[model samples]
Target: MGGTSSELRDLTNRLYERAEAYGMEVKTGKSKIMVSSTTNTSADITMNGEKLEELTKY
Candidate 1:
């Protein structure tokens, strides 16, 4: 996991791209982000340019 939102966002985007290249689809509606840190910063994560939902303690 990343130490910050931006880092995680970049990582997530790359993952989505790589997955698509392999004919894999990331179902954003069912996807979630779980941050392990104490920080309250939110990551604007997206797949196919759609924002992903964030979850706490999941």
Candidate 2:
């Protein structure tokens, strides 16, 4: 949804903070970042300080 990595990172930060505020756990095990680009840019995207796994298929 974000146009840049930083923007996407910011969104994750907000999501993590909000979830913590509500006492909800963001399951990192079920989280993933699927990139359609030819370059690896989503390695920086994370949830709750843990990097999200990138999938090539599904």
Give Cα-based local distance difference scores for all models: 0.81, 0.76
All candidates' TM-scores?
A: 0.78, 0.74
lDDT of 1: 0.81
The ten-residue window of minimal lDDT in model 2 covers: 34-43
lDDT of 2 by residue, 1-58 (tens): 5667677789878988999999998899898766656675444788876888876432
Residue 55 C-alpha lDDT in model 1: 73
lDDT of 1 by residue, 1-58 (tens): 7877888888898999899999999898898888664656566778777888987552
lDDT of model 2, residue 58:
23
The alpha-carbon lDDT assigned to residue 19 of candidate 1 equals: 98
Poorest 10 consecutive residues by lDDT, candidate 1: 35-44
Name the runs in model 2 displaced over 4 angstroms: 38-41, 56-58
Residue 36 accuracy (lDDT) in model 1: 63
